[model samples]
Target: MMNCIEAHGLTKQFAGRLALNNVDLTVGSGRIVGIMGPNGAGKTTLLKAILGLTPFGGELKVLGRDPWVSRDALMNDVSFVADVAVLPRWMRVSQAIDYMNGVHPKFERAMAEGFLSKTTIGREQKVSQLSKGMVAQLHLALAMAIDAKLLVLDEPTLGLDIAYRTQFFESLLHDYYDKARTVIVSTHDIDELQHVLTDAVFMDGGRVVFSCDMTDFDAHFHEVAVKPSDHELARTLNPLHERHSFDRSVFLYRNADVEKLATLGEIRTPRLSEVYLATISNQTLAQKGSPK
Candidate 1:
C-alpha cells in the first residue's frame, strides 16, 4: 500500500516551546488511523502540519507533496472537518452547499444533498438555529461528499451527544470509507473508536510514544489479573504497570512471557485505553527514575 502521509524528524515550536519533538510517522493509505492523545500532546499540531496550516522544521509530506509548499494543490485531493464551529453561523444549509460546490472542485452536490436529506437539517435553516448534533451532521455531509483521497478529522464530534457521536462514526464507516481512501481521526474517545481503527498512534508530552497496527497489539502487550496472593510472584516478572482493581491486582506486561503469566492468573487482551494508559505511565516512570 502507498503511504498517504510521511514525516521525518518533524519538529514544531510555539513561542520557543517545542510542540512536536523530532517526530517520525508514516500513515499508509486505506487505513483508519486514530491519533490518541490528551490536550497539548501535539495531536492538533501534527494535523496542522499535515494540512499545511502551520510551519515546522523537518520533512513533511501529505499525498507525496510537501504540505507547506503545495497546500492548495494538496487540498484538491484532501478534505478535513476540524470542528462543528468551522461552518459559519449566518450561512444557511443551502448556502453552505452552494459555497462548497463553488469553491471545491471535488465537491459532489448530489451526494452532499443525499446525505443531508436523511437529517432534520433543512436547506433554509441557518447554522445558528440547528442543534449541535445537527451542525455536526451537516459538517459530515459536506466532508464525505468530497472525493478526496485523504480525510482528516480533529474532534469532529466534540460537544455532541452519545447518539450523534455514534452516528458520526457509523456514517463514516458505511458511507465514506473505501480501500482507496485514508482517514485520520484525532480524538480522546479511544474506546469508542477502537473497533473502527486499523492502526493506533499514542502521543504524549509532544512526542509519539507508540504507533502500531491494532493486530500487533497482542504480540507486544498483555494484561493479567491475579489474586492478591499471587502479587509477589507477578512482580518478579517486572510488569510495566500495575494497579489495584476490586479485590485483585491487574498488571500490564510489555513483551513479557505470556505463557508464564497465564499460570499466575487470568490473562486477557487489554483494551486500547488500558494500553494507552500503561504506555504513557511507563514513560513517565522511566523519566522520573526509581523513587529514592
Candidate 2:
C-alpha cells in the first residue's frame, strides 16, 4: 500500500517550546487512522503540517508533494474539516453552498445539497440560526462533497452531543470512505471512533509512542481479568498495566503468552483505550527508570 502522508525528523517549535519533537510518521493510503493523544501532544500541529497550514523544519510530504511548499497544488487533492463554529454566522445555508462551489474545484454542489436535504436545515437559514449540530452537519456535507483523496479532520465533532458526534462519523464511514481515499482524524472520542479505525497511533509529549494496525492489535496485545488468587502469578509475568475492578484484577500485556493468560482468568482482547493507556503508562515508567 502506498503512503498518503510521510514525515521524518519533523520538528516544530512555538515560542521555544517543541510542539513536534523529531516526529516520524507514515499514513498509508485507504486507511482510517486515528491520532490519539493528550492535549499538547502535537496532534493538531502534525495535522496542520500535513495540510501545509504551518511551517516546520523536517522532510514532510502529503500526496507525493511537499505540503508547505506546494500547498495550493496539494490542496487540490486534499480537504479538511475542523471543529464546529468555523462557518460565518451571518451566512445563509445556500450562500455557503455557493461559496464552496466557487472556491473548491472538486466540490460538487449537487452532492452537498443532496446531503443537506436529509436534514431539517433550510437553505435560507443563517448559520447563527442553526444549532451546533446543524453547523457540524453543514461542514461535513461541504467537505464530503469534495472529490479529494486525503481528508484531514481535527476534532471535527468536538463539543457536540453524543448523537451528533455519532452521526458525524457514521456519515464519513458510509457516505465518504472508500479504498481510494485516506482519512486522518484527531479526536477525543476514542472509544466511539475506534470501531471505524483501520490503524491507530498514540502520541505523547509531541512524540509518537506507539502505532499499530487494528488487524494486528490482537496479535500484539492481550488483556486478562485475573482471579484474586492469580493476581500475584499474573504480576510475575510482567503485565504492562494493572487495575482493579471489585475482586478481579484486569491486566494488559504486550506480546505475552496468550495461552498462559487464559489459565489466569477470562482472556479477552484489549480495547483501543486500554492499549493507549498502557502505552502512555509504559512510556512514563520507562522515562522514570522503572520497570514496565
lDDT tens per residue, model 2, 6-62: 999999999999999999998889999999998888999999999999999989989
Candidate 2 deviant stretches above 4 angstroms: 288-292
The global Cα lDDT (0 to 1) of model 1 is 0.91
Worst 10 residues of 1 by lDDT: 283-292
Clash count for candidate 1 is 0
User: Please, what is the TM-score per model?
Assistant: 0.95, 0.95
| Per-candidate clashes, comma-separated | 0, 0
What's the residue-level lDDT of 40 in candidate 1?
90
